[model samples]
Target: MIDQAKQLREKMLQKSSKKPSRQTRVIAVTSGKGGVGKSNFALNFALSLTEQKKKVLIFDVDLGFANIDVLLGRSPEESIATLLDKDLSIWDIIEEGPKGLQFISGGTGFDEMFRLDETKMNKFFHEMSQLQGSVDYIILDTGAGLSYENMRFILAADDVILVTTPEPTSITDAYSVVKMVQAKDPNVHMALVVNQCTSDNEARATAENFKHVTAKFLNKEIGLLGSIPHDAIVPSAVKRQVPFVLAYPNSQAAHAMKKLAHGYLKLPVPYKLGLKGFLLKILFK
Candidate 1:
């Protein structure tokens, strides 16, 4: 596994060091706290991106949680942990979700099936570079935390989409994440998704205030990607192990997700870095 990882690292360095015609768009969808519906947003947003004719790969890095796989009604036999076996590659672990969308599970280390050493895991990490070139977008649904594991993944992305609710605590925690991320990379593409908003007015008010607060305190311009309304269908879809957008494409929340997808595509990308650049930084720096 470590050998394969090293080979991948070399290839990435060779590619990223030189200029490229285009850079793949990578979005790290994270939050200040849990239960803000970050996973739901990530899953449906990937589907929406595919709807826009973009090839999307959703990586579930939320430790111990099986949100994406469960939501898609799938039980993946392989995960990042399986790559340590010396026989499997990332292609072997990827599982099809819905509507031609795909996802990779960041295995829970608790089980024997996923236990891996540093070098072996690095081998798995190296293959991520191959993915950087194959897909149009890589949506990372990272675990909600400030730990090194979470930061490493978030910092490596081309953009960071912070999910927060209208609640005071949610906003405060989201700001903390923004601050942490800013401290790491001030130029990082930061965006906001106000979820569970009850009304259009509330969504506007909450998103605007949060944006203003981040700009005032952090001195960062956080893009207001869009907001999702508080919809019962969301929970109902969860219970049915399906994505709300696929089940209720006409729902307000689903419609909001599509708008967010389009809004994301409209955001100007910082073209200085490509997938190879992000891969090198994440692996070595």
Candidate 2:
């Protein structure tokens, strides 16, 4: 059994490493508002994907708040701020996370970097372009909102995973993001994950309602990326400064996150994004 598992691991690694492309698969995980557990989802989701042998990188681009490093019990000295100001390579700011997961911290205290002009954006993109060929996926965890920054990242990503809770306001705000994505880039692949639900039925009902409203009002079709239950283990894991997926691997949220990671891989990858194209998408008009 041990030998078979080892072989399977080797096989997955070989397949993941062989995924050559013009650009990495960029997926931005965002939300309409905060306090929806977006940060936790992003960190665990990336790590879970890594478990499947996918080379994963998290670009923590949240302007107002940054939580990934804190959640992992590590602090990064440098962040995207360094890239915006200094002549730093993408590699210079990347901090290593658990199990080879590479991440770039957000602009925590540097408010100026958040309001970047075209010149600053161009330079930032130029630096980010250097990471074009390095990984299988580049996941952006943007700040929760319909802010200009969030929208830019949302549209730029090849896939947008919008996180929301089961609350009415949360669902309403999430649909607002969907409307914006549709207006900006109707063709952008969009998915919704109902977080902090208590049961599968609740999650599904919320997802269905959101999908129905979006299809009816906005005429947009959004994929349901599955739901994460309101697991007690989540808060415990958070307090311990570890991912729930790692701390309680068999817990409800952990299982849900793993399944979500698997669903992410099943997404269709028709082509990869080139460096220039990637920058253009992020720096959209």
lDDT of 1 by residue, 69-185 (tens): 888888877776666664676666666668668688877662332334567646765766667655677788888867676787678788888998899998888888888988988
> In candidate 1, residue 237 scores what lDDT?
95
CA lDDT of every candidate:
0.79, 0.80
Residue lDDT tens for model 2, 88-189: 656667776788788888765545654578888878877777666667788888888888878877776777789999999888888888888888777877
Q: For every model in order, what is the number of clashing pairs?
A: 1, 0
Lowest summed-lDDT stretch of 10 residues in model 2? 1-10
Tell me the deviation in Å of residue 37 in model 2: 1.1
TM-score against truth, every candidate: 0.87, 0.87
- Taking all chains together, the TM-score of candidate 2 against the true structure is 0.87
Highest lDDT scorer: 2
Model 2 collision count: 0
Off by over 4 Å in 1: 1-22, 110-122
